[model samples]
Target: MKNHFKIYISFLILFGLTSCSKLLEEVPKSQVNKDQFYQNEAQCIAGLNGCYDNLTDIFTHNLFKINEGSSDLAFWALDDADASFAISPANPGVGDIIWTAAYHGVMVCNATIVGINKSPVAEGRKKSLVAEAVTLRALYYYVLTSMFGDVPFYTKEVANFDDLEEITKLGRMPASDTRNYLIKDLAEYAPALPQIKTSLIVGNRVSASLAYILIAKMAMWEKKYDVALPALQKIMGIYGSLQSYKLVDILFRNKNIEESILEVQFAWSATGIRKTTLVAAITTPPRTANTSIYDGVEILELGDKANPSTSITPSDHLIDIFNKYPNDIREKIVMARDYNDKWFNRPSRDNFEGKPWMGPKFWAIQMDNKLDGNNQKVFRYADALLMAAECYNEIGNEAEALRYINMTKIRANIPILEVYPGKQSFFEELMDERGRELMGEYGRKWDLVRWGIFYDSINNTIATENEKIKANLRPYHEFYPIPDEEVFRSKGVLTNDAYKQ
Candidate 1:
C-alpha cells in the first residue's frame, strides 16, 4: 500500500497535480489546474496524495531541530541557531523550514478538500476522501500552532491567484481556537472515516484511529483533558489489549509494524521514482558507502545515497537516562556509544562528536546511497498508551495511569511503575518513562511546553554540553517566532511580538 501510494504521488507530481512548496507563499494553483482535475475518483485520490507529500518532509532536519533538537533528548551537533537557542526571526533555520512546510501542507489539504467536495466521485467515497483532507489539514494546523503558537488560520481554498491577497491579509489566530476548531472538525469527520485497525492496514492512510489520536493530541496541548481522555480511550478500545503490542526492534528496522498507527510512507526505487528521504542519513553516524573503517572498527555504512549529515545528535541527559536503566531493553534499540560490539569512534561532529550513534531504531540497513526508504513512524500505539496514561493521571485516575504506563514498561522488561506518593510524582515519572520509550522521535519539546515545564527542564538540564541552550533560552522561546520574511510579507498584519527587537 505504501509503495502504491508513493507511485501515485510520483505520478501526481509529474502531471503537475501535486502542490509544491511555493504554495506557502504563492497561489496553490498547479499547472494542471484544479478545474480540469478532480473530475473523477482517481483524480481526487491523487489530490489527497499531494496532501501526504509534505508530511514526508515535515520530519526531516529542521523540524527535527524544533521537535527534538531544541528539547533535552537531542541537540544540533554544531552551533546551529536552534542548538544555541539564538534563532532570531530574521535567521531561517527551524522556523522557516517548519513554517513553510506546514503552511504548504495546509494549502494543499485545503485544495484537496475543496476539489474532492465538488468531484464527481460517489457520495460515500467523496465524504471519506474529504474527511482525509480535513484530518490532514488539521494535522498541518496542529504543526503550526504547536510550533508557532498562533498563526493565520483559514480553511478556505485559494481558488485563484486573486485570493492570495486575502490569504496574506489574514492575521494570526489563537492556538487554542485553532485547536478547538480542529477538534470539532475531526469529530464531524470521524464517523465518515473507516474504523479499520491502522496496524492491520500498515497505516498507509488516515483511519478513525489516526483521527482520534490527532484529536487527543491537539486537545491535550490545550490542556482540555476532558476532551482528550475519551479520544485516547477510543483508540485504546479500537486497538485492544496491550498484549498485542510490544517494544521491539521494529521502529525503522521494520516499517509499519503492528504497533504503528500512522507512518509517513517512503519507498526506495532503483528508478529513483519512489518517495524517499535523508532522515536516516541525518540521524545516523557519518560514513562512506563501503569499507568505512574507523579506529579498528568497521563503522557500519548507511549506504551511498545521501551524505550522512550528522545534524542532530543525542544529548548527555538522554544518554544518562538510558544508562540509568542498564537492565532496560530499549537502550540497545534506541542509542549506542558503540555499534557491532565496537566503539563508533568516527572523527566528525556528524557522528555525535564521536559520542554515540542513534541505534537500530533509525539505521537504514538497506539504504541506497542517501535515499533511506525507512518510513518515519509518526504515531504508534505505544504513544497512544503513554498519552492515555498522561490523560488519566491528569484526570486523577492514578490506578488507570499506572496500568497504561506499565504496559510499555512491562514490554521494555523494565520495572513497572507500581506506586507514587502523589499525582505530580507519578506524572514526573511518566514523563521520564515517555522519554525512555520515545527518545529520538518527535514531540518531546511540545511535551515540555504543554506540561509548562519547558523553561525549567532545559534550565535544570545537568548536561554541561548543553549549557549554551540553558544560557540563551528565554521564557518567550517556548514557541518559535514567525519568520521575519513571513511577518514582513503580511504587511504588518502578522507579528512576533514576543521576539520584537
Candidate 2:
C-alpha cells in the first residue's frame, strides 16, 4: 500500500477536480475542495498533485487512437472512424475525449495555481509549487492548441459564478498566441523549479528538465528554432553524455527508467481506482491462450474492445521502412509478425501471413483484467536528442545535427551516415528517424502536422490499402475539429471555422 499511496492520492485528485461536462461547471466533491482548501504547504502540494493527475487523463487510450493509430506508424485494422479519417465536429470519435480532458486539465491547473498563490505556504516553497502548476498548464494548453487549433484559452481560475459565466463567453485564442504565451511563461517560471530528474517519483512530477523540453517542443512547432535550440541545449547539458540512457528494446517494461523525462504513471489495483492503462489491451492482438514466445506471458481477449472488429497493428508502410534497414535494432522491438506461437493472420508459425502486431515494447507481460500498469512515456531523452539535432540542422549547423542523430543510430547499432544531406533532405530523414525511434509513443500525427505533410502522408499510405484515409483526409484535417459540445457550450464564442466547408 505504501508503494501505491501516491497513486491513490493522484486518483482522488483526478476524480475530484475534473469534469466531463462543461469545464469548471461543477464544484469538486473530494476531500480537497477549492472553496476551503490550500491553507498550508501540504494542501498546496495536494492541489499541485491534482494538476499532475490531469496528465493521466490527457495521454489516454483515445489519444493513442488519434495520435498514433491514425498515423503512418500504425493503423486501426478495423473500420474505425479515426483510422479512416472520418472524424468531424459532431462525431469526433476520440477527439472529444482528448479535447475535454485537455481543457479539464487546464482548468484544474489554473485552480491549483490560484489556490497555491493564496495559501500561506513559505515563499520559496510556494514559488516551486506554483511553477509546477504553471508548467502543467502550459502542457495542457500545448495539447489543446496542437490537437484543436485556436482553442478557447483562459488562465483565470473559475472561482465564482461570475467567473464561470465569463469563461463561457471566452473566444478561441490564436494557437500561435497561445504557444508564444506559454513559451514566455515557462521561460520565466521553469527556472524556479529545482533541477531534479523527472524519473524520480515514477516520472509523474514536473521538473526543470521536462519544462525545458516542453518549451523547446512548442517553439519547434512555431518554427522558432532560435528559441528551441537553447532550450534543447539546456537538456543536453544535463543528459548529453548519453551514458545513462539506452535504446532499450522494451522501454515501458520498467517504469521511470533513466531514459524517461516524463511518464504517465499507472498502477495495478484490484479495485480499479484509475490505476491501470488500456494501452496493451488496445494495441496487441487479442488472445486467450498462453502460447507466447516468452515464458510466463499471459494473453488476454482485450485488444479489440476499443475497435471490436479488429486490432491495432503495425502498418505495412512502417514494416517496409524497417526492412529498408535490416540492421536497425528497433525493428524487432517495435513490431512482430508472430504472437502466441502463431503468425498474425495465420493459424501457426508454419503458415505465413506477413501481418505484424505491435511488438513486445508495448505488451503487458501479465496484464490484469485487460489492463496493465505500464507507465506511458510522455517525454524521453532520446526525443530531446533528436529535437536538438533538428534545431541544429535548422540553424545551419549540420555537423552538430549529425552528432546528435548519430547518438541514436549508434545506440540502435545501425550504421551512421557520414555525409550530411542539405537542410531540406536532412529534415526528411529526421522525420523518418523520428518515426523509427518514437513510433508507438504519441507524436506521429503531430509530427506530420508540424511538418505540413499530414494530408500528404496519409494520402501516401493509399498506395498500400489506406484508401479510406486518402478519401477522407482533408487539408484542414492538419488540425482536428473542436468538439461540437465545446462549441455549443461556448454559444458561438468558439466557432469551428477551419472545419467549416
Candidate 3:
C-alpha cells in the first residue's frame, strides 16, 4: 500500500458496519451487499485495503502493552496494579483488546476473500487479491492461536444476521490445527505474492520472502527445526544480507530498506484518522529536569494532553545486558541514557528517577511528538538470521549456526564469537541477542512462551517486582484466557476455564 494512500470510503463504510459487533456479526443486507459492492477490480481492491486497515489498528499501543509488557523486558507503567500480570481471563486487560483487534482483522480478511472470489475481476487479479486476503487471514489466526491457545476459527464471511448462529456456535480449534492451517495457507499463497516489492506504492505489502519467514517462525514455535530450515534458507537467498548497523540513518530513518521484510506503513500525509502512529509518544520518556547535560540539544516533547507519553521504561535487566556489549551499535540505537544518547551503563538509583532508560528505536526525529509517521518494523532480515541460526543449532549444525550469529554481530561492530559451550548455551546467547536486537519491536513474550521458559524466567528473575506477579505465574499463564466478553457473547459455546474464579 502507498504511504500516502487514502483508505477508500467504500472500505470504511463496509468495515465500519462489521466492527461494531462480534467478528461473526453481519451487516444489513441493504447496507453492504457484497454481491453488489464487489463487482469490479476497484471494489475488490478496496475490500483488500479494508483488510490491510485492520493491521494498522492491531499494531497500536495496546498491542505493545500486551506483547512486551507481559514479557520480562517491559511492564505497563500506567496501570501496574492490574497490568503486572495481565495473563488472567478474569482481569480483562490489554489482552482482550488484542484478542478483539486480531479477530477483527481476520473477519475483514474473510470478507475480502469471499468478495474477491465472487468479483468479475480478471482471473489473475482475482487470484492474487484472494491470495493476499488468505495470507492476511492466516497471519491474524497465527497471532490469535499463538496468544490464546485455541480460538474460534471461521473461513466464511457473515452475510446476514441468520449466519450469526452458525458462526457463534463454532468452538475453538486446537493450536496444532491452527498452526497447520496457517502453514498450509502461507505455503499455497506465498508463491502468488511478488518476490520483491518493486516500488514504494506496494512497499508495505507482504512479499513471498515475508510469507516464508512467517512459515519459518510458526515452525520454530512448534520446535520443528527441519520444517523451518528450508523456508529460512529461501529467505536468506532472497534477502541475502542484513542492513549495516553503522548506517544509523538508513537503519531507523528509512522505511522498507534491504533489511526490512514487513513493516506497518505510516506517513503523515496518509489520508484518514491516525495516519501516523503513536509509537514515538508511547516509547519516549518524559524529559528530566536536568537539561544542562546536553546544553543546546532539544528534547523531544513528551506527553501532550491529547496523546500523553506512555512512560514504558525498559527493565534494569535489559540495561545490564546492553552494558555487556557496550561496543555494539544496536545497544546504542535501541536504548538511551538521555534523549538521543546511548546508554552505557545503569545509572545510580537517584540519577535514574525521571531518566528511566527508554527505547529510541521508533522515536522519529520529527518534533511533533504526538503524530509520529515512523513505520513499525514487524519483520526484519536480522530476525531471519537469528531464526536460521537457532534452527541450525537445534539440528546440531553448530558451525552453520555460529556463522549466521556472527554475521549479525559483525554488522553491529561487535566481536564475533569463536565458540559456544553447547547447544543450550548457544540458545541462551540467541535469546539474549534477540532481546538486545528486537527489544522495542515487540515479540518477546511469544518467544519466551515458545521456548517453554515463560514461567521459570518470569518467576525467577521478574517476579521480584511484586507478589501479584509472582502469584500469577502459573502453567496456564503461558496461554492468555479468551476475553470474557467473547465468551459471554458466545453464550454456551465459548468457555474460560483457564482463568481463576
Candidate 4:
C-alpha cells in the first residue's frame, strides 16, 4: 500500500490496457485492486489528481491542436516563417496526437469512474467524483467524435485488462450514438454539479455551469437547437458577461476566467511538471544569447523546452486577417506590433518597437509558468455570441444576426457589425470574424473544416510550400496516417477505414 499518486496512475493505465486487450483474465499486470486503493478520502483525491494528470500526455495536445492546424485560421508557416526544418505533416490535415490522446483520456475516465464506483467515500463525494468523470468523459468523447467520426462508448469499469480487449474488438460507434451518450450523462449529472467559485488555475471539477456549456456545445454539434438553447441559457445566467477589458491578466492567468465556461485541468506543482507552453516557446522570437527577452529556448533551464523543430508561427494570412478587422478586440488578444506600428506619420512616429509577431495569448508564459494558470479556453462567451449570430443569419434574420455580432464589437469598442437589408452570405462573414478572433486558439481549424474551406486552403498551402521546397501532395494527406502500432494492435477487432494506415 504505497499510497503514492504515481503508483495509482501506473495501475490505472494498466487497468485500461488490460481491459482493452482481453489478455487479462483476472487482474491486469498494470494495476492494484480497489482493496489496496481508495482506503481514505485523501487517497481518493489523489486518484482524482492522477486522472487530471492524464491530459499532460502528448496525445491530448495532438488531438486539440487540430483546431488550429487543419483550419484556415492558421497556416503551417508564413512566406518568411522562421522554422527552417518544418516538414510536411502526414495526414497533413489532422495530427496523429488525436489517435492516442482521445483513447488515453477515455481510458483514464474508465479507471477513475471505476475507482469512484468502488470507493468507500461518502455518497455525496462519490456523486461529485462521478460528475467530474462524466464531464471529462464527454469532453474526450467529443474530441473523438470530431476527429475520428465515431468511437465506442464505455461507461462501466473494465475490471481488468481483458475487458479492454473485448471493447477494442468493436469498431467505431456511430457519431449519433456517442454524442447521445454524452448528452445523457451530462444531463443526469450537471444539475447536481456546483459552479466553479475559484479561478481557472486550480482544476475545478465539473461545475453545473461548465456542464451546461459543454452540454450546450454537444447539442449544437448534434444540431439539436432546442436542447442546446436551454443549456446555453443556463450558462448565460452563470457566466454570461464577457471577460472585462482591463483584466488582461485574467486571460493570462491559469485560474477561472470570467469568460471561461470550461477548461482542461493541468498543474505543475512538482518537479518534472509539464506545462502547456509548447506553442509559446515555438512562436517566441528566437533568443540570441545575452538578450533581455526570455524566448522559449532561453526560458527552459533544463533543455530548451522550445521544440524549434515543430514551431508554431503567425502566418501572414492570420496577420492580414487581424488587420482587416479594424480596431477589433482581437487585436488586444494577441500583440504583434512594436508598442506601435500603425500611424507612423505623427510626431510620435515609430515610438513603439514592434516585432514581426508576438502575441500575449501565446507568449504570456514568459512572465509566469503554470503555463498552468492560463487555460486553453474550451468554451468562451465569444463563441456563444458568434454561434447565435450565425444561427440568426442562417434564418435570414439580418437584424437579429447583427444584434449578436454587434455584441463582440461592442465589447471591443469597435465599429458595430452592420447587416444589409437583404444581407446574404452570413456564413462568409462568420468565418471571417472567427479567423481574427480565434487565431492560434485552435478552434479555427474545425470552424474552417466544417465550413468546407479546408480543401481549397490546404491545397493552396501545399502548392505554396511545394513550390518553394519539394514534396508530393496526395488527397489522403488530409487525414493523418493511422499509427502503425494502433493499426496492428486493434487488428483482431474494430478496425475501420480511418485506421487504414
Candidate 5:
C-alpha cells in the first residue's frame, strides 16, 4: 500500500488536472487533498519528479511528430496531422497534444513552487527545488511559444475552482513577451541549480549547464548572438569537450553520459514507474516473420515483426547528404540504409514504402520486445558546439566559428575545411552540418523556422518528391494552429486567425 501510494503521488500530478474544463471541475478538491499529502522534502521532490515525467510524455510522441516530421529531415508515411500541415483550430493535432502537455507541466511546476515555498524543508533544499521548478516552467513556455507562436502564459497555481474564469479568459501572450519572460526566469534561477547532479538516477533533473543551453537556444531564436555566446561559453567551461565520436552509438544506449546535457530516462520493466521509451517502436522498421532478401542482401531485423508500425521515416535528401559525406561517422550511427531497403522491399499494407534512410539511434534489442529502455536526449553537447559556431560566425569571428565547427567535424571523423570563403558559404555549411548532426533529434523544423527558411527549405527539398506537400505548405504553416478547444474555451479571446476554418 505504501509503495503503491508513493508511485501514485509521484505520477499523478499531471493526470485529470490538464484541460480548462478539468481545471474548473477538479482543481479545488485536488489542491485540498495534495495540500495535506505534501509536507516534507521527500514529498516535495516526488512532486518535482512528477513535473519531469510530463517532459517524457511531451517528447515521447506529438512534440517529435511536429518538430521532426514537418521538417525536411522526415515526412510521415500517412496523412499525419502536423506533418501535412492539416492542423486547424478545429483539428489541432500536435498543437493540442503539446499545448495540453506543456501547460499541464507548467501547472505542476506552479503547484510545486507554491507548495515548496510553504514546506518545512531546509532553506537550501527549498531553493534548489524552486529553482528546478522555475527552470522547467521556463522550458515548457519555450516549447509552447516555439510551436504555437503565441500561447496563454501564467505563473500562478490554480489552487481553486474560482481561478478558472480568469484563466480561461486570458488571451495569448505575444511571442516576444513569452521569450523575454522565459529568459528572465532562467537567468534568475539558473545559478541556484547545481552544476552537476550528485547521482545518475537524478541526472535528468535541471542543472545550471542545461539552463544555459536553453538560454542560448532562446537567444539564438531571437537572433541575439551576443546574448547566446556567453551561455555557450559557460557550457564549454563546465564540460570542456564533446563526447568522442567512437562513443556516439553508446551515448544513446546509456544515460547521464558526458554528451547528454538532458535526457528523459526510461527503464525496461514490465511494471515500474518508468517504462520504455516510444522512440524504438515509432522509429524502428517492422521486421518480417520469414527472412527475406533484396538484391542478394538479407533484410535487417530492425524490430519485431508482430509490432509493425513505422510511422516516421528519414527523407531521401537526408540519405543523399549522408551518401555525399560517407566518411561522416554520424551516418552509420544515426541511420541505416539496410533497414530502409527492407522496408522498401516489404512495404506496409497501406502502400507506404520507406524512404532511403531510417533512424536507428534509439534502436534497442528488447528482451521482452514489449518496450525499449532507450532514453530520449533533449540537449546534447554537440548541439552546444554547433550553436557556439553559429554565434561566433554571426559576430564575425570566422576563426572562432571554424574552431568550434571543426571540433564537431573532427569528432565525426570528417575532413575539416581550411577556409569558408565567405559568411553565406559558411552559413550554408553550418546549416548542412546541423541537419547532418541533429537529424531525428526533434529540432529540425524549428531550426529552419528560426532561420526564416522553413518554407523554402521544404519546397526545395521535397517539392520534386511530393508536389502535394509543396502545395500544402504556406507561410503561416510555420506556426501551428491554436487548438479548437482552447479557442472555444477562451470565447474567441484566443484564436489563430491564419488557421480559422
Candidate 6:
C-alpha cells in the first residue's frame, strides 16, 4: 500500500482527498489526491506554501483571539450580555474555520514531506525541507492542542474515510502525549533548519531556537525540568540572548530585535492583511498611516463590528499584576484610557487621556494604522529563558532560575529584582514578568492555565468589573472546549465531555 501510494496519481489532488505515504504511515498531509500536482518540485513547494498559510491563519483567525483572551487578559468581550458565563458550546462556527485551517496545515506538511520523498531532488535539500515541514506541523499541533485539546493526531494525510474516522476518534492523547510528540518533532528538525538572518526572515522556515521554544513549552507542561534544560541550554548558548533595552522602544513599541525566535511572515503592504488589520496585530509608523483601514480598535468596538480576530486587551487583574511597574515598561505598555496623537507618538513620555492603546509589548501603529508596519514575533529568547527559569524553579534549582530571570530583566533594562521580591512569591514574580514582557504576544492565557490561576483571576475580574454574567472560568476553558462538532464525529471515543469540568 505504501509503495503504491502516489499523490500525483490522480488529477484532483486539489481537493485534499488522499495522501502519498511510504511504509504505511497513517498520517500524511491532508489527503492530496495523488495527481499531476505532486509530480514536480514546484508543486511540492506550493503545497508546503499552503501549509504555511495555515499558521498565519491561526494568528489572524479565531483561536488567537479566544485563547489569549479567556486566559487572563479579558472576559469573552462579547456584545451579547449572556457571554459572561458562556456555556459549553460557544460561537457561531468561527472555531470551525480555525479547526479546518489547523488540520489543513498539518495535511499540507504531511503531503509536502511525502511528495519530497517521491521527488527526484537531492536527498540533502529534500531532508532540509522535510525538517521544516515537520517543525511547522509540530507547531501547528501545538496551536491545535492549545486551542482544542486532544486534536486528532494525524501525521500523514488519510485519503480513505475509514482511516479518517479511525484517526479522528483516536481520542485526546494525554496533553503530555501531544506535547511529547511536538518536542520530538522540534528536536529532530531544529538542527537541520538554517541559521536565518533576522532581516532575511525566511529560511527552510524554522530555526534551532524556535525548536527550543517549543521544547521549553513542552517541558514546562510536563514539569520535566531536566529534559527541558538541554534545549534551553542550546538556545542560550546559540541564539537566546535578549536585545538590549531602549527606553523609548521598550515603553512605546515592544519588539526585541534580538530575542525574536519565530515570526509569522508578513510583508509591508498598503492594502493590509484582512485578518491582521482588522484585529490590530499589524502596525505602521506615522509617515505611512493608512486611514481607510479598519484598525483593530474599530473592529474591537463593542456595538456591532467587534472583530472576530482582535488580540484582546489585558484585564484589570493583568493591569494590577504589573502595578509594581508604575514607571516600568508595562504600565506604559498600553493606554489605561484612550489616547490620541500627542501621546500615541511619545507614549513613554508620561501621558494622559488614554484609551485602550495596544500593549507596550506590541508597538502601536503609525499615524495612520496599516498592516505593513510591525512584525509579529512567535518565539523570543526572553520567553525561552523565562520558560527555563520556570523549569528551574520547579526543579528547585533556585540559582539557575535566578540566572534566567535576571538575564531577561537585564535585557529589558528592568531593575534586577529578586525572584522572590518582597511579599511576592517566586511564582507570582515569574507570572508578573510573563505578563509584562509577553503580554499580548499570545502566551498569557497558557501561562494562566498552566499555573492554574484562571479561576482566581477571571472570577476576580468579573467581580471587579461587575460584569453582567458570571462564567465559571473553569479548567475546561484552560483548553478550549474541543468543538462540539468534533465530538459528534468521534463515536464516543474523543470527547471533551469526559474531562471533568
Candidate with top lDDT is 1
- Which runs in model 5 stand beyond 4 Å of their true positions? 1-29, 197-203, 243-247, 271-274, 290-306, 339-355, 367-371
Clashes of each: 5, 0, 1, 28, 0, 32
Model 5 Cα lDDT, one tens digit per residue, 331-425? 76676555444544423325554454354575655423436676777777788999999998888998998998888888887888688657888
TM-score of each: 0.87, 0.88, 0.85, 0.77, 0.87, 0.77
Tens digit of lDDT per residue, candidate 2, span 168-264?
7888888899999999999988888867667664335788887898899899999999999888888777665765566773356678776777788
Q: Rank the candidates by lDDT, best first.
A: 1, 2, 5, 3, 6, 4
lDDT string for model 6 (1-501, tens) is: 222232322212223344544313533332434533556656566656655776666665244455444545554455432234354544423456667667767766776677777777677777776777787787877777766666667686555555554566577777678888788777877777666523334432566666677787777777777878898888777663455433344332343354567666544434754424233432211221223223322321122312223334456666676666555644554433323323333223346322244443444343123232244566666778788878877877777778778776765557775644432367778887876677656666667666667667666664355354343334455555655666665666656663444
How far out, in Å, is residue 83 in model 6? Answer: 6.8
Model 2 regions more than 4 Å off:
1-35, 201-203, 271-274, 289-309, 338-353
lDDT string, candidate 3, 1-501, tens digits: 221122222223323433535333434433355567788988877777777766776676666665676567765555453346645555756667667678777767876787788788898878777877887887787778777878888787755555556777778878877787788788888878777631233646767777788789888878888888888887777766674433363333467666677777777643553567676766655433434121123443432222336556666567667777889877656666644443323332465543344545656554253677667777777888999888998999989999988887888777777986699988988888888777766578789889998888777655665456776567677777886666766775878776655
* Stretches of candidate 3 exceeding 4 Å from the true structure: 1-32, 197-203, 243-253, 269-273, 288-297, 300-310, 339-356, 367-371, 466-468
Worst 10 residues of 1 by lDDT: 1-10
Per-residue error (Å), model 6, residue 370:
8.9
Give the C-alpha miss distance for residue 276 in model 1, angstroms. Answer: 3.3
Q: Whole-model Cα lDDT per candidate? A: 0.75, 0.74, 0.68, 0.54, 0.71, 0.57
Better of 1 and 6 by lDDT: 1
Better of 4 and 6 by lDDT: 6
- What are the per-residue Cα lDDT tens digits for candidate 1 across 238-286? 8887667667745675777777778778778787767776667667766
297: Cα error in model 1, Å = 3.2
Candidate 3: TM-score? 0.85
Task: Please say which candidate is ahead in lDDT: 1 or 2.
Answer: 1
